[model samples]
Target: MIHEKFTKDSIISLSNLTVIKEIDDYTIGDEQKNIFFRVPREAVYVIEEAEGHNTIEEIQNSILQNKKIEIDVLDFMNTLNNLGVINNISLNEGHRNNFIKNLGKLLFNKTTVIFYIINILLTIILLISFPNKLTPNYQDTFVLSSIGLSLLLFFFVSWFLVFVHEGAHYLAVSATGKKMNFQLSIRWFWVVIEANMNTLWSISREKRYIPFLAGFFIDILIINVSFILILIINDIFVISLLKMVALIQFYKIIWQFIIFLRTDFYYVLLNYFGVSTLTKGSISYLLRKISSKYSLFFDQLSIREQIICKRYSWLYVISLFAICYLFLFFSIPTVFHTLKTTLNILSAFAYNTFEFWDSFIVIALIFFEFILWIIAAYKRFKRGD
Candidate 1:
């Protein structure tokens, strides 16, 4: 005889993730860290047959009556137990629901949406009214009168703006009456606030779109508000600072369109087309094409799925081109310019002067950022992700 512990509240359902091929996609879920464990269809049958009290042989006998299945009962039990999804402590739904409701109350509704629309329109109009302030003068705005202080200032300001951006996403998710989790982590050498996307799956697709897009909307708001503030502010230092922040916000807006990065727009595109794994599928197709080998990448899909992939592939290629162009045209030039300016400043100032120390700080920051980039890249490579 054998005994097993499995949660009565455990869910076995189709996965929300989009896949390349049409296969039976199922996931097991419990209240464990909002994570789901995906398994084969046969595993679902095994779980259903287990029923906690039944011995492994008894469960096997029941399943075998209908079909032959080969699953190591011990291994299966261990996996679920380790995942804390089977026979785990029950979640306090009442407390969770109450928290979600409280958060939901803070979300923007129709009336608030209307107000936001009006503000957004007004902001655009204001931006169009001020053409000179749109072009960024990084030196005056970011460097201030002191070069040494610039990197530290830039880091803090950028962090604040990102906090606001992520906060917008949090509010958007809350508005949809979904639970959200946030983590501070590094991505591509930059520290970023990561919102748990798994929580979004419980909500409507349309509702999910806004949460993903909320950051970009906030970025636009930042830019527009900076422009407005610049008009009223008399201080050159303040104006220059705001202008630089505005330019950074503007660059963030452009960053959203790089769909190859699985950016906010990437999610938008996926939701709009009602497809999953579009980017991965497109890349595979492109790779096959490059090898002068036609594969059945599209033929395996349903006609509708085929069309989505076919259309999305071109956009994926376009995103790749945009990334290359941005790196070569924008990134390289900025790095070169910054390095040259820093070197000049360092040369002009004596080692004992504040200016030299300032230049040294900027140089140190540059090296630190580069090191972070290398660490991130190496980790990703080792993980084969």
Candidate 2:
């Protein structure tokens, strides 16, 4: 009985899997485990033949007869089994709900697409019509009744917008029949809410674009609505608040385009090139070029990957320099000036005064943001991410 079970004639039990064809390879994997592999066309044929009805020997015979190529049937079966792709499993629905799924689909329909385009065009027209609002002013951030209250309001509203951004990514992933996991994380010095859409690997490359760009799309929508409200609202306070909201949304959209920060556009570029480790690989490639000590790391990459890394290294280097320069000159100076001004205000005003409270609030907000960044960074380090 044991010998018979081990024979090539034994039926193969393939797990539920998703297979997508890329430009040069096929992406096949078990979505339940969030594991995927890029294989050649021939490997896809082998996988297709692994239905329960076919025995291992029969699958090999069929492939050989059709493609005139030989493959080790038992070895392939073992490989799949090791990868947990030869087991029975179902899609994990514990994190998903029907309402979110339906809403996700609704948000990406043809009607919504038309509105998205219209919103973008209208926003451009408004910006052109009112060129004064094109530049963002820091004064807009303090448009509320009191400076302290305005600062608090901006903090809460900024976080609310961040939630909406991540929510858009979640909805887009749901639309593609996948669920997303979100985490409060830090990117460089900024505290960010990130959505992990790794399950998207199971879908086609083209379908992944919307989920990646969804945050930007929603930001644009918010900016468009804010601009419209600013035009219609006669009250100065309301107009100022709307302009501030629009300015923040505009900043979010621009931030997404900073590819070096591994923003949405960065992922879009990775998907377009069908390269998974372009950023890491590019950095390794540059390091290897700088010294022989890094040769071992660069040599670990395949020849094709090496070429890709070499090609992308220049862009990475340039972006790195640009970011370093910006941080040293713009960001550092802005921080010092803000801190100096807040300290002066605090010293000039009595503790009972609104001016003193405003400076206190600014310091408290800065400290709060710093604490969040520290926690996020610690969590990231613990996870080895």
Candidate 3:
């Protein structure tokens, strides 16, 4: 029988998935799959033995004599071949190469990096020296407009900034000369900009930091540019709008600290620590202490996983509380306050009056966020992840 061989790029890494031990993990990038898979230790040895120099009988006989175990060489070779590890076919290798090459052309060089640092420093100085002037008056955005118009403006500006943020991330990834997969999806209330981060392993640890943070930098850039525009534009309406956008950007920056949301900062911390599954593993570690089911599965984790869990469990708890605090203190209160106040104002006007309709629209928009949370929760429940 013909013997299949491991590709030259096929690498066997000792992966620590559980708290107890290391396991064989395979990375076969030559086929352009760009995925890692855990495999049985014996399977790894079998692939190693199948170097194509030995026939199936010769390989199996050698293993049996050395380890005294029965083996099926054909099935094993077929399994590895099926997994794309043997590189039997060329799959998008050219596309992947071209993408990285093109991305190299768009990356920010050393000069641009210096400029970014200077820009951020200036923004900090300006914000410190003139907080009141730079601060946004959210009231100007909603109080002066009809409910419908305010909602439209808010969404337009918010989405515009969001796109720019994602674009910054795209450029950051490209700068590293790596392939990235970017997609737009809505999960419950927020439009999420999802970027596939599997290939992050291929880049240097320091370089990975920029892609995670590029979005926030882009946000700061926009805020600074808007500040300059604010100085030049005399129109009160345009000035107010810019201030509002700037305010929202400020809020988003603070929102990064709420780690339970798995914001950009969370990823940065995870990358810095060199852990793959911090939150999930930490939560599972906590769960294992309370239940047998959790323990049974958790016991399978490697030592690295256990360490990640122990190290991050406190953070997980703090982030959980932070999420609750924000929800209860901010989200719940704001929605209720807005709804109650709007209803009272509407009661003072006839239902057919513009004042009543305006108030009604505000209430609807407020509830939109709550509706999104409900939808997202329901989705998670159904998927059982």
Candidate 4:
């Protein structure tokens, strides 16, 4: 939900924005930094980009005029959406109705909440109906229809989880009385609400991780309950549940090991290293470790991490490059794979809706990824990283 035109050090000054006109769901504004808008802290980075005084037309043009949304861009937008981020809007009252400015924020917030509630419900329903709905086989047409209907019902569910994820961050930081900006994010393909309080760098790591991690912990809790529900409902509705389209809801839960795609696993790795940032430094360390000359730097590292770094440093580098390249160079295959799965889900209205191939491909890819992960984990584990 966040937008930006990255042109150097532009910072939006709210005073400069004037609602030039309004048309239906859209509003036109003159861009400038003078008029500071009250955005959730997370969205300020994009807001920072709006400082160059490009008109609304220019912003829209950037999106529409472009052809393919490249992997870097997709990643950027995805990051904006999925990570806790916010959008900056014209803040001054005179520019437009004061309450109206809040419209976007309110709508986005509600969207996030609704997503979480639905995920909880659907995940639970799918589980109790387990292996039946989620399995690779179902022969009846009527059962297939039921499953298709279930998926249709749950198709638009996800952003709510993101909102909770971000809201936890907002509340966590707010609890410490830290000032934060609210922003929505689109990390990869997911939309999220975010609280911007990087300023909390001054806070201890535990405090920071509490806010950073609250969302995933909650997700794990939901997954566990869903697993229990699968057991509870197994005897009564296993076959019927299979007929329902809500199966495969637990795949994400099952494949947590793939641990790519900037999920909580990434956070766990970063936390393990005690590094505040990973995207930059991890890469640097990876590049340097290739040379024996940097062995001294590795030696200088803390006993625990030095061993980890020295051992899996190559894995760290490869993983970083792989993610970036998978996103950029292999964008076509990635998008194609995503689209193929989407179509398969859509076809559930007619087909069996269960296939060995479906879970196999996804889970297999993750498994392969884990095999590589073992290489890194082995070094870390052996060295106590």
Candidate 1 local Cα displacement, residue 230, angstroms: 1.9
Model 3: residues with Cα > 4 Å off, grouped in runs: 1-34, 37-87, 94-111, 135-143, 176-178, 182-191, 202-206, 227-235, 284-308, 317-334, 345-351, 359-385
Clashing pairs in model 1, backbone N/Cα/C closer than 3 A: 7-87, 18-276, 148-358
Across 29-122, the per-residue lDDT of candidate 1 in tens digits comes to 5523565444667777776675545666666566777767666665666566666555423344333465545554454555555655666787
CA lDDT, candidate 3, residue 355: 71
Report the lDDT of model 4 for residue 96.
35
lDDT of 2 at 222: 93
Q: Estimate each model's TM-score.
A: 0.73, 0.80, 0.67, 0.38
**In order, what lDDT does every prediction score?**
0.64, 0.77, 0.62, 0.42
Clashes of each: 3, 0, 6, 43
What lDDT tens digits, residue by residue, belong to model 4 across residues 275-319? Answer: 322334334456565865454554554555554544444555555
State in Å the error of residue 150, model 3.
1.6
Would you give me the overall lDDT of model 3?
0.62
Model 2 spans > 4 angstroms off: 1-12, 52-96, 281-337
Instruction: Report the poorest 10 consecutive residues by lDDT, candidate 3.
Output: 14-23
Highest lDDT model number: 2
Model 2, 80-166: lDDT tens digits are 766666664344546668898899989975567678888889888888898785544556666775666787887898889989988
